[model samples]
Target: MSDLPLDQVRTLLAVVDEQSFDRAAAVLHVTPSAVSQRVKALEQRLGRVLILRTKPVRLTGSGQVVVRFARQLTRLEEDTRAELGLVGAAEPVTLPIAVNADSLATWFLPALAAVPAVGSAPAVAFDLHSEDQDHTATLLREGLVMAAVTSAPNPVQGCTSARLGRMRYRAVASPAFVARWLTDRPLPEALPAAPAVLFGRKDELQDRFLRGLTRRGATGVRHFVPSSESFVDAVAAGLGWGMVPELQHRADELVDLAPDHPADVPLYWQQWKLDSPALATVAAAVVAAAATALRQ
Candidate 1:
């Protein structure tokens, strides 16, 4: 611990955050050569290579550990500054978090709205990243975000997770779309032949929903709509049928493919196990908002 220097550690973090050695130097107000030297020194001291030579500079596993430590150190310093009442308007406390696109388009922003300290209110700013619910926790693992809305119930190492209820999705389609495709046959049989919408190339909600009904993955013409709003809009525009979140607008009376059952993705809030009040405040607001917006 004593051998590891703060300057080198902070330099490594800056390089990762800035995505380039030269840019890291710009942020730290040091020469680019100095930045490189510090990173090299740190790697030698730790006996590990941290950053890859990629354009954006990818972090190795060892790099992730060091970056996480650096972020936590910054967080602690900010907390201490706030506690000592030394924080001024010049620098706001930054709280970075990851959220699913669906939640971000719906309840997550409202939850943040209730918290005065999360954005523009107090000396605080938010670094919000949108990710899929199933994968948001990976941001926390990579030390990219302090908290995340994830589908995983199990907390990441050195973190805690709390249930935030479930967001239900219903297989829905435009009235015209249903009449053109699904109405001609049973859903299990027709859904396979019908045009479908996907959240992204990685999306499998439609496939999963189909699998639940037919024990087979969705097939036939498929369109990938990556934007949360656009995905729902495409379904309403009759581009394709898809699993739409209950919160999104229904331009047409949605024929719930399975009225008796819905796809419910349970959500959880995961944050680093920290003593900082800012994280707790945001977590509390998120949980409170979920109680009203999601199924218990």
Candidate 2:
């Protein structure tokens, strides 16, 4: 296909972001029919059905590609404007990134704060979306974020991937929990029946640990605490045994259930291979901080 028209591509992005044609029109200060027409023209040019027209407007594979291109074009335009002194003094660049909850709770924010300013504005304003390390790349793939702290080492299409080291997790439980559920029984026998704390339904750390010892999944009551800090708090409050990040694990309150079976989830930094100064600065800060905060 010929070069995608910037106006139509941007209009499609607006619809994706707003989740509706009417909202996109309001944002772009155009009629809803105009928005629809632009999107339709773009789709016709590409010979692809870009949108599913669902309630929230789901994008097709072709749509995702176009949206990613639109976002990159916007990023490049902003960078060019900033370099040429065309940008307003009050507007700082906003960089959107995907990060896992554990890293966000521990080392991620500090890294962002340490990023040096491109000029007068404080580094760049941040828009963070936190998800599991295993799933953060999904946001990157969907054109939702520019960079991600993900478990996958493979690059996503136009992105570069760099190793950021591992976040080690140790199986741990409160003294009371151990006393009540695991005092006399063998760990293999008691653990399968004992209550357990999990970060989310997708969390497999605790279950993975159990599988190593018992050759089965945890069959007991499961408590889901999604936040990293709160997951640790839930375990400390005797909610159940869980896998706590080594950085967040407290020696006094929680005892390691198995020192030999630590779950080491290696994290990687993934970002679009862009030449923008703001993105490069943030990437440097994140890599440097990860070197100190994460296990090498």
Q: In terms of TM-score, which candidate is strongest?
A: 1
Tell me each candidate's TM-score.
0.94, 0.93
Q: Write the per-residue lDDT of candidate 1 for residues 62-157, one digit (tens) a residue.
A: 988888888888888898888787888787789989999999999999998788745333355789998888889988998888999999999999
User: Scored by Cα lDDT, where does model 2 land?
Assistant: 0.90
What candidate 2 gets wrong by more than 4 Å, as runs, is 117-122
> Model 1 — TM-score against the truth?
0.94
The parts of candidate 1 lying over 4 Å away from their true place are 117-122, 251-253
Evaluated at residue 11, the lDDT of candidate 1 is 94
Worst 10 residues of 2 by lDDT: 116-125
Residue 254: error of model 2 in Å? 1.1
lDDT of each: 0.87, 0.90
